[model samples]
Target: MNSAQLKIHLLCRGIQLDSSVDLDADARPILRTRGGLASGIEGILPGGLSINIPVYESFAADSPFSLVKKEEKYYVFRDEEELSEIVLPPNPKFYSKKTSSGKLMSRIGVMQGTYLGIYPTDICEFWKTDPPSNCRFCSVGLNLGSTEDIDKTDADLLETTLAAMQEEKITFVHFNAGYLGGKELEILEHYIELIKKNTPLMVGLQAAPSADYSIYERLKKKGVDHLSFCIELFDEERLKEVCPGKSRTIGRKQYLDTIEACSKIFMRGRVSGEIIAGLEPAEKTIEAIDYFAKMGVVSTVCIFRPLIGTQYENLPSPKPEDMIPIFQHLYRTTLYNRIPLGMAPNIKVSIVMLAEEGRGLIEKKGFRLRLCEMRNSFIKFFISLYFKIRIRYGKIRLGL
Candidate 1:
């Protein structure tokens, strides 16, 4: 399909999609369209869209493209027929087991779509005060405050994680913790060590930079496959305004320094930095991506989605058109450097599709325009979802 046609198809599909209750506003609609539950696109295509299911075994009986029903039947929909199917991954016998502390092992960590996401600590230090010092994009602290007994001790986390590995065939395990008072990074190290000691699964850790090199050494010893020091933004002035607590705790240079140090330890193609798109000027984002690429770090460009209770709630998301070019540039740079798209699986999936279609053709100096169409599709899906939910829910208040 032509780039223009592909962009239009993606936007239309994204807008008409439906979702399950648990999916975030944006993902729900996209899931619906993907599942063939939503309407439109009857005549435009030659025999409907093709869905490729990633092969992995899990207790969950549903295919990636289909949803499981309450009646214990798998539902698969196509343009002409819907089929009742049975697709099963060997049930991890360990899933039925509990931790020594009597916590349900399954509840300790969750599989969000495809990724195994675990929260070591649900509380952030910044949330303890008025006008909390947490990052503007985070809702972890607020969510933790609303719930009782949110903390997952290091032992329990490790035990449950081990059980998950034994029971579920997880491809990657992602560990994210709330900002601990002063020991956030330290606590993360403990969990990392335990996981390293126990399993050989791919591990990705996200946290602010630590105070010392020893922590990095400890992490390396524990077998961290990927590391993300989320600097979040590149504009120094904007960094101060948006993430004052982070700015004070770890300055931009220090954050960059940490990534450099980690890159040295982890080596190129293994270290990454996170940059939230739509938060700073296009130039700033471009500069950060180029800088990270030069330093052998993959720049994970996340679209700035304002969480329900964060400070930037009223702000509008950057239009997809605005972010498409930026994504294309970064994707092409990484491709040129032979950097495997690190830990950001979803973005990699989309970009790979674009690359496969020979969209990496247009060039303005060093930047390419081929991936923009696909990038814009992702952006449109997210923005449309963001606005729809905001309008319906009217500022979601996490019961903090």
Candidate 2:
């Protein structure tokens, strides 16, 4: 099977760990994200397909696929047949270093794939309410304060990012916050500015959509490179049932309107509308991909992983067959709309199958799509080189 199919299968039907495997010594230390995915082993398959395979989920214990080490080399097997050699993300040496404020850099910002993912605020307010309106599929409240530090200072964040850039050679820093009563942008703006003025690293943010669209323009003007709004599910009724706090406080229309407004502000492929694929039907997920593509926003889909402490913990994970069509549509819709993709240099996300990586899932390509692919490949080279040069220069000069 191709890498894309392998990715889907491993994600759906998780792999088991052989007795010979010592994850603590060999793998990226699994940190359960408050975003509720990616609490697993970070492995890269052939052709640069990076994935965070489910290692902690209950379903992983009874899988056909398994991992074992041979002569210090990592390999994944399916039913006692070796399928492919696996490459693990090297555990960062800088994780042991500390910030100027005496906080461990790893506690301040953790690497999610190639980017530095920092949650710079306290818990989402939904989880703090008396009734607790947190999303049924989210584990933000459960994971925060226990797994990582909360309310990190801006100085602490900058110190951590610098350590990561200097040691790990990172190109991007992503800052996301929980709902701050409409002040997420306000609270994060200073942190964003410090990174923009001090480093050439590309900046990205994800939070609930702002009530005021002008805040997004301010963020863009401050050199924020990308912005994503998590809408969770496309079916409004299902969304209401699943994300009660969001639906009651911020209507579904607000997410769409905010996404459309920001799409025009940021260039195409710079804005994304995020949705979970398995919670709603595949058709709904396809509709969302089409909707985002039309609005000049790339759709970021996360397959629903039933995180251990979330309300949906007892629920079943989505099957691989069920998810193949959803991601296949992501490739088609993004390309059909002429959105530039695979332009960011070395931003490989382990948690989800990237839209660009979906190229492997398609069996046939039409002549028009072939032309589009060629154009994108050509664009990717120059654009990536530009960033590479900027990053190299920035390491010495320090700003874009």
Using Cα atoms with residue i matched to residue i, what is each candidate's TM-score against the true structure?
Answer: 0.64, 0.97
Q: Give the per-residue lDDT of model 1 (tens digit) for 9-97.
A: 23222221113312222121121111011111111112222221211112112222333333433333333244333222222444446
Leading candidate by lDDT: 2
lDDT of 2 by residue, 135-176 (tens): 898887887788778858878888888888987788999888
Q: Would you list the C-alpha lDDT of every candidate in the order shown?
A: 0.53, 0.86
Question: What does the lDDT read for residue 178 in candidate 2?
Answer: 77
